[model samples]
Target: MPSKYRNFRSSVPWIILFLEVVLIILFYFLFSDDDDASGSTNSYPAFQDVNHMVIFGFGFFLTFLKRYGFSSTGFNLLIIVLGVQCSVLIEDLLVLLLQREYKDGLQRITKAAVSMTAVVISTGAVLGKANPVQLILMAVVEIIAFHMSRSINTTFLQVSDNISMMHVHLFGAYFGLAVSSHFSEPSPRTEKNASTPKSDLLSMLGTLFLWVFWPSFNSVLLVEEKTKAIYNTYFALAVSAVTAFVLSLLTAKDGKFRMTDIHSAVLAGGVTVGYAAHIIEYPWIAMILGLLASGTAVLGSYCLQRCLHPALKIHDTSGIHFTFGLPGVLGALAQVVLLVLKDWTKSPRLDYLVMIPIGAFCLTISVALITGFLTGVIVNLKLFKTIPVSKYFEDQFYWEFPHLAVGF
Candidate 1:
């Protein structure tokens, strides 16, 4: 990379931070009205749990790389901070333009946090490969695409995804994979890509946080049947965790559990169950979804991921394709089935029950792939600093290693 470009890249964060401050100031003055002030306080508790999942759960989860612990957690935090601001501005602008109203307080902040969740999942797909500036750029563009796709689903398609499974998990996974596909290079394995016992333990802590609070994530935005959503999520996650452990042992060559499988596959139930959380009235049904989700995730981790690199040239760093992508699609399909079965005789517009979810599913993929590819193109342009292949997963590229100093 040229020195000019390196200098420019270093200034990008400062520029963005300044712009965020300005935008936030403008937002407060321009959109701060009585309606915004009167936003409900009921959602605060759920907001706290979901916020924790975003900041801590996702931040630590990506620290599995042996040499990239600092960048993993640091970039996660940076992306979320940028993502939340951009999400809030875009969502509020969309609401004002379409509905002729303003939104604020815990409601919009919670929604922004949820939107950033998708960005974080996408970040997982390209974790060690991209620079901080590129990641920030990706978050801004992805947030815009997210709101657009969401509007299309809710307003035009009339889709009812109470937990945003399709819009968040499915979209995020595919988008990140698409970006990864664009950034893919054929390089031999390196120590930087490997994990240590300590790193894996830290990553497991993140997974545990996500698993415990996933019920809150699924039920946060619901006005009714919150208990049902929470119960279904908990039931599904419990089953998924047990299934993940058993399957990990079965799938391994030495018949032992893999930390990676436990890290992601155990949370498959949370992602898969959200699509139909409100509709599934039976615990057995939630358990079935859990079993299917864990199986799909474990198989994808064990089987499909290997094939993906060779076949499609997609190097999913965190295996988001299996954990979020495939399981999310399964959740969407499950919702389709429940929608048809449960609403077959009751609803007048039965066509919507089938068409909306399917359409939203297809639309989410199209938007994610297109936007992600475009973002990848922009990130790879000569204007930004390029990461050398040798430094791909090494924290020394971006972080200080004081312990390595002879004087120290």
Candidate 2:
């Protein structure tokens, strides 16, 4: 291929990457100035609401990316990181917009309708092969996990617990569904009967809508407090994405891993940084941590997919290998590394050290096991068994499309 045309063809994706980096940097600078003016003597919660909303929204979006058309394995990986960033940031911005009061009944109705509409649309869009009832249960479990964090005394520990718990909940829900889809009583439908997974065109068409808006998700509120951390994340993501892109081509399963997975490092790095985004002072440490995180996430996901799943003969693609599982682990590791570094460099506090990981792990495990087991049992009993668990809600439309066959 001629360099000119090739560049022309690739220019769009490159430009999109450039714009995403620029936006993240721009946001960082804006926040950094505020932080500098405020000085290090003062510290706030680091704009958490914005971060939580963004992560939640993005995580939710990734679950349905295949249906939206970016089903290529590689692209889907990248979508995981990018989608989380985009959804969280956009949701954060929306919440900001919603904070304003409106006196007119018409405006109130419009806002209410818009908010409710978004919840409905987002839910419907992602449900795919999932039953609406199961989806509701999943959401309920997630909410319970969220409230559990409130009981913790330390803010840092609370945040960490929330991150870990939410992931476990997600893993439990998806894994439970995958298991039920396979082993549970004769459902008229199963994974084998699923509608062909759609290539998520929305991902390719938009060229990482979330990546471009990365800053909105990361530091919209605490840009000032964590300016350096914010910049580090963006800088790392840019480098990681380029690296992933080149490697993705070399490792392509035709289109299985999609070019997006090339940037898998970005998500791992982002999640790793997410833990210390507010207070990590050492630039060198942050850089090294981010780089190591990327490698770990990629390798970890691969090992889990190959060694663990096949051994069990469990083809739950949405479980430990994907969705929130690996990302959550990466997040936990990041916390550990940051904490270790702090303890080594500063005074060691054994009590706090022991509490962080133990507390997080225990909470996550309790929630996941309880939720997953119960959900599995419920689904196995043939109650609410009509729910869709495949990619297209194929079961629901089966009557209209008689040719569609389900399996165990």
Identify the candidate with maximal lDDT: 1
lDDT (CA) per prediction: 0.85, 0.42
- Clash count per candidate: 0, 18
Q: What does the lDDT come to for candidate 2?
A: 0.42
Candidate 2 wrong stretches, greater than 4 Å? 1-128, 149-198, 204-207, 220-224, 253-257, 263-266, 317-320, 387-408
Model 1 is weakest, by summed lDDT over 10 consecutive residues, at 30-39
Measured over all alpha carbons after superposition, the RMSD of each candidate to the real structure, in angstroms, is: 2.2, 14.6
Instruction: Write out the backbone clash pairs for model 1.
Output: none
TM-scores for candidates 1 onward, in order: 0.94, 0.56
lDDT of 1 at 364: 91
Residue-level lDDT tens digits of model 2 in 267-305: 445545555555567666556655665565566556755
- The regions of model 1 sitting more than 4 angstroms off are 1-9, 28-30, 33-39, 161-166
lDDT of 1 by residue, 102-162 (tens): 5546777888999888899999988899988888888989999998999888888777645
